[model samples]
Target chain A: MGRYFLSKLIQSLVLLFGVLFLVFMMVRVTGDPAALMLSRNASPEQLEALREEMGFNDPALVQFKHYITGAILGDFGNSLHFKTPALPLVLERLPATVQLASVGMLMAIIIGIPIGLVGGFTPGSVVDSIGRFLALIGQSVPNFWLGLMMILFLGVRLGWFPTFGRDSWNSVVMPAFVLGLPVMGQLVRLTRSAVLEIRGEDFIRTAHSKGLEPRTIYLKHVLRNVAIPLVSVIGVQFGYMLGGSIYIEAIFAWPGMGGLLAQSIGWRDFPLIQAIAVFTSLIVLLLNLLTDLAYSIIDPRIRYGR
Target chain B: MSIILQVKDLVTKFYTLDGVVNAVNGVSFELNEGETLAIVGESGSGKSVTMMSLLGLIPMPPGKIESGSASFNSEEGLCDLLQLSPEEMRDIRGGQIGFVFQDPISTLNPILTIGEQISETLIRHKGLSKEQAREQTIKLLSQVGIPDPELRYKAYPFQFSGGMRQRVVIAIAIACTPKIIIADEPTTALDVTVQAQIIELFKELRDALGVAVIWITHDLGVVAGIAERVLVMYGGRPVEIAQVMDIYKDPKHPYTLGLLRALPSLEAKESKRLKSIKGTPPDLLIPFKHCPFASRCDYAFDRCWEEIPPLISVGEQHQAACFFDLEEGGPRHD
Candidate 1:
């Protein structure tokens, strides 16, 4: 187990480097940072001074070396728009995104798993039909559209919640639900199918023949078998929630990393964009590693290297 | 002899997209206390289906018991199995009739340890506490000849070999000490060596616990070794019933004779060719007024094609579903 975890750690570190390199190269090579930072009417000498001061005039290789070293040492320079430390600025926005994504995931699991269990248990019953219909509606509608609809329906029409901005606890509900609905729909469908398939396995029949209660049979035999595959989907969907939080956060005016990244992209803030991209990639890589570890823990047949 | 269980004209049908397929058509049998009854047939002969129906294990909607009456001699009285509620049936399933299925690896949960699987049955049916259940589970495991029972108790299904897994399944089946044990092709998925060991285990359990067993299999060789009374099934119908030696030595039904001839005898000379039964089993979807095996039988005649043969008595405790006289001229081919 120790050896397995060590290999996963090494893999994650390699993945981190690959993501950092891609983000660094793409940000620098695609557009001129200094040109974007300078004013539209700035003189040529002023632009040259700014470029020299920012080390943009240095050789690309030398600049890359300095950037890599600075990034490693927590010296990400100043944000062009915020005029603050780039690392602190990005870190400050991370908790909001984490909070939103975690709550969204919690909601998805709480709502989705039970629906799936009921659907799988009865299969062709009314509960299954209703679950399928709800899942279809959840999946077909866009997240932004759903967010807008919730804001209009609950926020404006009912006057029960705020339309935008994270001011109160009630403010998190709309955005989280908007972000979670589609994911929850997919989870419900996946979990139902997984449970249905597992219920047909010979082991489950054996359990039934053993005179176990239906509840015990479901919880002990069926759920454990279904959970193995559900873990991977949960991890992948959690990563997706982080990625897809941009629209929901924007609609609710929640001051999260996704929203900050969107603003940075609009202003073409190179440091902030690079930092957010690298951070998002790191989170995704970490989630995938966690998922692999969870799978191995659940089923010991899969070994990392051996 | 006291009859322990009696199944009368049990018919199981499956409602598929095409039509109603009668998987088990009007099958009947009886089991007395402490008797080893073997249901022998080829694949799709409804041997397993008929046994599953007796226990109410057949899935509903797709598969249903169309008509049947299974009576068990319980403490109350002879209770009709078909008339019992689901809850009442649940009480009888593991409490009175224990079942051991084929494919032990698939029968045991991969996530749970062998001890847990065994204890689950004990706790549910025997009402044993966790500690008591664990103690009994260890004893049961050791009873089934699992070496180092304590360590094996913690080991998961995949940790054990296939033979050990089957032993674990048997341990679970006998956990509640039910009066009857139904082993459905228990040795089919095992190796040849393991098969003999499992059969021996069943015999030992029968001798020790005095539990009646219904061993279901398609292999005639297995029935020859373990069973006392044999019921030969063909296309969802029992074509013959007799004692073990009588069925093997003086076989009556053409299907049984064909099955016995199909098996290669060890004492046969090197130059002799082994007989093989011709043609596949008849499709149950097509309605048959005559004998289901008429198309494949060598002794099929004009009368065999026009009339269905009833299970007629040939001798004391021997019955066969054939019109021809076994003593007169054997069976005449058309």
Candidate 2:
């Protein structure tokens, strides 16, 4: 177990470095940061001073080395737009994004799993038909469009909920649903199919032959067996939720890292963008790691190097 | 001997896009207390389906029991199994009739430990408390000849070998001390040596507990060795029914004669080519108007083509479903 954990840690470090290199190269490859920073009407001397200050005058390798070392020492440069420490600014927005993703995931699991269970157990039933219909809608409808629809229906016309801005718990509802619905739909379908496949397995029949109630058989044997694959989907969905939340956050005015990152990208704030990119990658990687650890808990064979 | 379970003209059918396919057609049998009745058949011969239908294990909608009755004598009275509600069927399933399936690895849940699987049955059917169930589980495991039962109880299905996994399956099946145990090809997945061991285990359980066992298999040798009486099925219908020794010695039906001839016996002086049954079993679709075995039977005639033969008595305890009498000579092919 210790050796496994060490190997996983090394793999994570390599992934971190890979993300950093890709972000650095791709962000620079698009356009010159110096050109973006300097105003169109700026004097030549002023532009030159700003370029030198920002390390554009240095060799690319040398600048990369300095950036890596400084980042390691917890010294990401100040954001050009926010005029604040880039790391602090990113961290400040981290909680809100985490909260949104967490709530979205919670909603997906809470609602989607039961729907999937019912759908799978009774394939041709009305519940299954409804589940499939909802799943189709969820998969086809884009997140931004769903957000707009929720705002138009619930916020504008019905006046049942707030349209935009994260002011209270009630405000988180629309954005979370908009972000989570697609994921929930996907999960429901995945879970339904997984459970259906599991139900056909001989072990499930054995469980039934044991005189176990249908609900008990479902909860204890069927769900536990299906959870391994479901966990992987959940992990991937979680990362997508973090990354995909930007559109919903922007539309709903949610104060998450997604909204903050979008604003930084619009302004071409290099430090803030880099910080947010690294932060999001780290979060996604960590979630995947946690998912790997959880596999062992779900199935003991996985713990013994499966 | 008093009959404990009786199946009368049971017809199990499956509805597909094409039409309804008769899987088990008008199958009838009876099981007395403390008897071992083997239902022998090739693959897709409805041996498994007949047993599954009795327990109401066949999934509804796609698979349904179209007609006939499965009556069991219980405390309430003679109950028709087909008439029971799903809840009532559940009560009879694990409580009275235990089932051990072919593949042990698949039969036992991969995620749950052996102890939990066995104890779950005990708790559900026997109403044992958690601690009591655990104790009973260990006892049941030990009963099935599993060594260090207490320690092995915590082990998962994948941890055990094929024979040991079958033992775990047996332990779970017998946890409630069921009156009737249906072992559907229990040893089919194991090696020859392991198969003998499992077969011996069944005999030991039957002798010790006086439980009636319905051993379903395709192996004629196994039927000869373990079964008291044998029901030979072909094309979703019973071809012959007889005492084990009688079936082996004076097999009456053409299908049974073919099955016996197919077996390579060690007692033979010279090595001879074993007879193989010619042609496949007829398809169940299009409503089998003629006898199911007539196409494959060497003794088939014009009469065999037009009518379905009813099971007729040959000896005191032997029966065959064939129009031609085999008492004159061996069966003559047209």
Candidate 3:
């Protein structure tokens, strides 16, 4: 297990380099950073001064070398728009995004699993049909539109939840639902199909032959096997939730990295863009590692190099 | 020995998208206490379905127990298994009548530890606490020939080899000292040496526990190793029933003879080409009005195709469901 962890750590470190380089190159390619940042009324001399100050006049490779070296020393350069360290700016909103994303994923899991189980258990029954129908609607509807609908109805009309911004626990509900909806749909479908496939497995027959209670058979025998696939999906979906939170955060005015990213994109803040992209990709790589570890936990057959 | 189980006219069917499949057509057999009865048949002969139906393990929607009675002399007394509710069936299932399915790789739960899988049955049926179940499970592991009972108990199914997995499955089946163990092709998924070992292990467990065993397999060669009585099923019907020796020596049914001939024998001086039964098994979707094996039987005649043959006494303890008297070279009016 320790060996497996070490290998995965090495793998993630290599992947981190890939993320840093890709984001750096991507942000640079999207038009001139100085031109996008400076005012139109500024004279050529003023623009040149701004470009020289920001080192935008330097060759791309030279600038990348400076950025990479600075990044190694925990200096990702200041955000062009905020005029603060890009890494710190991204990290500041990290907790909010984490909070919203986790709460949303938790909500999806708490409700989706039981509903999916029931649907899978009965298959063609009424509950199964309804669960599948709701999952379909959840998957098809765009997250932004769903957020708007929730804000209009639950927040504006019903006064059940606040329309925009995160403050109280209740305030987080609308955006969290929007964030979790697609993931919840995926969970429902995967869980249902998993249950359907697993219940027919030879071991389940062995369980039934043993005369275990319906509840016990499902809980002990069925659920453990089902969890293997579901855990991996959850890890991946959670990563997706983090990246996809920008739209939800923007729509709801939630103060998170996603909101920072949205505002940064509008102002063409390349450093902030690079920092957020690198940070989220790192998180995704970590999530992939977690998912691999989870496989060994649920299925003994999966082994690392060791 | 007394009869432990008597399954009468077990007619199980499947409601398929194509049509109603006559899977098991009025099958009947009896298992004696402390005896090994092998049910031998080709695939889709409804051997597995028959066992599943008796255990109440058949899925109700597509597969249904159309009509049947499995009068098992369980700990709860002589109860008709078919008449029992799902809850009642559960009580007898792991308690009195344990079942080991085919395919060891798929039979044991991969995620669960061998100890947990084995002990869960003991907990449910014997009311043993976790510690007690764990203690007994380690003993069962040793009993089923799984080495290092203590360490192996904590191991998962994937950790074990195919033979070891089957041993774990056997341990679970015999966990509660069930009155009967139903092993459906337990060695089919295993290698030849492993298969022999599993059969040997099963024999040892059976002798030690003195529990009745219903060993289901398609291998006639396998039947020769462990079975006391052999029940030959063709197209979901028991075509012949007799002592293992009798079935092999004085085989009355043409299908049984064909099965025996299909097996290569080292005892024969000349290498005889192994005979293959001419036709495929009768389509289960069609309702059989006559003998199901009539089309395939070389000895099949007008009477064979005209009427459904019932199991009739051919010798003191042998029965055959056929119209022709192979020994006399004529169709028996009797």
Best by TM-score: 3
* lDDT of candidate 3 over A118-168, digit per residue (tens): 999988889889889989988999989888888888889999988887777
The candidates, ranked best first by DockQ, are 3, 2, 1
Give candidate 1's error at residue B320 in angstroms. Answer: 1.2
Query: Which one wins on lDDT?
Result: 3
TM-scores of the candidates in the order shown: 0.93, 0.92, 0.94
DockQ values of all predictions: 0.63, 0.66, 0.83
lDDT of each: 0.86, 0.86, 0.88
Ranking by TM-score: 3, 1, 2
Span of 10 residues, lowest total lDDT, candidate 1 chain B: B325-334
Ranking by lDDT: 3, 2, 1
Name the docking class for model 2.
medium
DockQ of 1: 0.63
Q: Which stretches of candidate 3 lie over 4 Å from their true place?
A: A27-66, A167-169, A303-306
For candidate 1, give fnat to 2 decimals.
Answer: 0.62
Tens digits of per-residue lDDT for model 2, B1-334 = 8898899899999999988888998999898888999999899899999998988789877899989898888656789988998888888778788889999978988888889998988888878899999999889999999999989989888899999999999888888888889999999999999999999998999899889999999999888778999999988888899999999888888888888889998999999999999998778776788888888878887888998888877888888888877766544333
